[model samples]
Target: MPKDQKFQKINFDLINNLIIIPIEINGEELTFVLDSGVSKPILFNLSDRDSLQINNVSEVTIRGLGDGEPMKALSSKGNVFKLGKVKNYNQDLYVVLDKEINFSTSLGIPVHGILGYDLFRDFKVEINYAARNIKLHNPDLYKHDPHSKSQTLRLSIERRKAYVEGTVLMENDEDIPVKLLVDTGSSDALWLFREPEKGLEIPEKNYEDYLGRGLSGDIFGKRTKVSGIKIGDFELKDAKAAFPYRESFGFIKNLGDRNGSVGGEILKRFNIIFDYARGQVTFKKNGNFRAPFQYNMAGIELQHNGLRYIAESIAGFNGVVKSEEGSFGNVQILLENKTRLSLVPEIIVSGIRAGSPAAEAGLQAGDVILAVNGKRIHRYKLQEVLKMLNEKEGKRVRVLIERYNKDLLFSFVLKKVF
Candidate 1:
C-alpha cells in the first residue's frame, strides 16, 4: 500500500448548523454530514442503493431520539471510503432501510448519510468554520503551532464518543461541574440533563417546546438561557440551552453517564480541531464568538423546495387551499397574458408552534412563504430565514404567503413567551 498523504484540504458546506462533506463510498461520490457524536459511519437516504456495490451485509436495528419504535437497518462491511486525499479500506457501515426521513428539504441541500468517529480516528482534523473548510492532517506528521492562542482540552472517549469536563453556573450563583459530550450534530447550544440528585433542575424561566425532529419523531424539551459555561480557559455567558424531558429521552438516558452536551450552536463560535487519536481537542474563537444566542420566536418551521410555480384563476376564492402539508403542492394559478411571474425557490412552512407569533398571525403548516420584512424568501437559505425570525424579541415581522392560489399578507411581532 502507498503511504497516506501528509495533509489534505477539504472544502465543506455549513448547512442548518451541520458540517457537510463530500466523500466517496465504494467509488461513488456522496454527501455526508460530519458528526462527532456518531461512533460509526452510517449510510442511508440513498436514491438508488442497488447502484452501490457492497459485501457482507446483515440486518440490524437502530434507535434514535423520537417516540417511534426502533428502525430496521443493515450492517455492511468491506467498503472503501474516501475523504479528500485520504482513503480507508474495508470499512464498516450501518445502512438505514427506511426512506421516510429526508434531510435535504430541511437543510436546503442533498445529504446522503452521516460520517463520524471513523474519520477522526486516523487524522487530526482542523475545522475552520469561518472559512467553511476542513484540513485533515496525518496524525504522525501533525504539529500544533507554538504561537497559536488555541486552548486544548483533554477528551475522554467512551464507545467512540468524546466528552470534556466543564463548569456551568446556575441562576443561584452555584457553579456545578459537569461532563459534556462534544456533539457537533446537535444544533442546540447546550443540553443539560435534569438530575435532581446532582442539584440540576430546569432553569427558572423556560418554555415547553419541540427541541428538534429525530429519526423516530419530534423530540420535545424545555428551552432556556443559562447563566454561563466554562470550558478550560474560555467562558461564555447567557448561553441558550435546552433541557429535554427525562421521560421523552429514553434512548439517550441509557447512554452512559453524562450531564449534558456541547452542540453546534455553541461550537460554531470557535474554530475547532479534533485530535481523536491524541484524545484532545482545541478551540479558537471566531467572529461569531460573542454573538448573542437566540431561539426561534416566530414559532414556525420552514423547508426548502426547488423552484416551481403554477397559475390559477382568482374568480373562485376560498379561504382554504387543498394541498398536502410537508409535501410539494402543485396548484394551478391563472394569470393574465401580460402578467409576469417571478421564479424563485419555494419556502414552505413545515410546522407551527402553538401561540407563537406566526401561529397568532394565522400561519399554518404548508403555507408557501413568499417574503419576510418585504425581502423575498428566495434571497435567503432556510437557516438565514430562521435567523431573521429569531433576530430580536418584539421585532415586527411582515410576511406574505400563497394559499389557494391567492397571495395573502400578514404581519406579527416576535415576542418571548417563555
Candidate 2:
C-alpha cells in the first residue's frame, strides 16, 4: 500500500503562461507557490494570522533583493494541510506573521502557503521546464525497468542534492557530470557550472545577456544551449541554460561537494519523486500532466548600478537606499581590541539573508551594525567586513549607530539559522 493513497490525486495545468494549484487554508481557498527550493512551507496572510494557532515563536530572518527587514515568525504543528489530495500538517511548518503574504498582494492569488520539501519527500517529482508542467507519482506505482538500466543514467538525489552519479544512457550528451541541487522554485532557465572552472561556458551563437536577481542581488549570466540533459533514462534536448561568471558567487565555490542547481525550467516534464529520507529522487516521463492554472516564479528582483550606503539610512539623506549609488559615507570607530577601523557607515539592511550570523542575532533593517562582535567596522572593504562578521556567531556584539544624528547603541546576540 502507498502512503495516503486514498487521497484524490490533484491535477495542475497552465493559465496565462503560469502554473497554479488550488489550495485551502483555514477553510478558505487559495493558491500557493509549488516551491521545491524552500527549506520549508510558509503561509503569508494577515487575515489568517489569529487563526493560524502558532504554537512556538522563533526569530527568523531572510536575505533577498529589496530592503530586508526583520519580522516575527508564527509556527505550529500542522500535520494535515491538504494540497489537492496530498495532506501535510503538524509536520513542522513556518509562516510569516505579517499583514499579508507576498503572493496574495503581488500575484493577486490567495496563496495559502508554499509547498516545499516536507510534502515532496514522499513522492517522485518530474518537472519539464521546457513544457512548463509537473508530474507526481506514488512510489508503489513506479517501477524501474530492468532493461532500461543497461543504458540509463542515474542522478543521486539525496538530501536535496542531485548529482550525476553515473550514466544510464548517453546518446545526446552535452552536460558534463556535475553535482546539482534540483531547485523547483527557480522559474527561469537553468544554471550550469563546473567545480574547477571559475568561468562558465555559453553558446557561441544566439548568446544574450541573461539578467536576473536572486537572494543575493543583481546577477548577470551567460546564455547557452545544450543539446540535452539526460537523467535516469530521460533526456531534455535543445535546453536553454545560463552560466553566471561573477565574484558574487564565491560561496557557490564552497558548496564543497555540490556543483549547481537543477531549476524548474528543466524539471517540469516528468512524474517526479523526491525522497529526502532515503536520499533518492525518481522521475518518469509523462506528457499528459497538464493544468489550467498559472503561478509566478518566486523571486525578488534587484538592480545593482554600483551604489553604496552607510547604516540603514542613506548618508546625508532621510530614507533607505533605493538605488545603486557611487558612494555613501565614511565612519571611523575604535575596535574593542584597540584596533581602529574605518568603513562606510551604512547599515546593511536588506539582502543579509537568513542563516547568516547577523540575521541569527535579531538584527533588523533600522538596527545599525557598528562592529562585528568586538571588531570595529572601519576602513574595510565589503568583502573584508563580511569575513569579519562570519567569524562571530552566537556571540554578544555591540552595535553603535547614528540614526538621525543621535548616537544609539544596541547589544545583539548573534546566531546562525541557515
Q: Judging by TM-score against the true structure, name the best candidate.
A: 1
lDDT of 1 by residue, 1-418 (tens): 1265668989998876789899998889989888888888877777634578767999988877676778888899989988766888889998876886667678876678888888788788899988989998877777887336789889888888899899988888788899999988887789999887886788989877878766666778888877999888889998788898765567764756799899888888889888887788898989878987767889888887566653334555554444432223234333454332334458899888877889988988998988788887665767788777777887998889898888899889988755
Model 1 reaches what TM-score against the true structure? 0.88
What local lDDT score does residue 67 receive in model 1, on the 0 to 100 scale? 69
Mark the regions of model 2 whose C-alpha exceeds 4 Å error after superposition: 1-7, 15-19, 45-53, 63-80, 84-86, 97-112, 124-175, 194-199, 202-220, 245-253, 273-280, 286-418
The local distance difference test score of model 1 is: 0.80
C-alpha lDDT of residue 360 in model 1: 86
For every model shown, what is its TM-score relative to the native structure? 0.88, 0.51
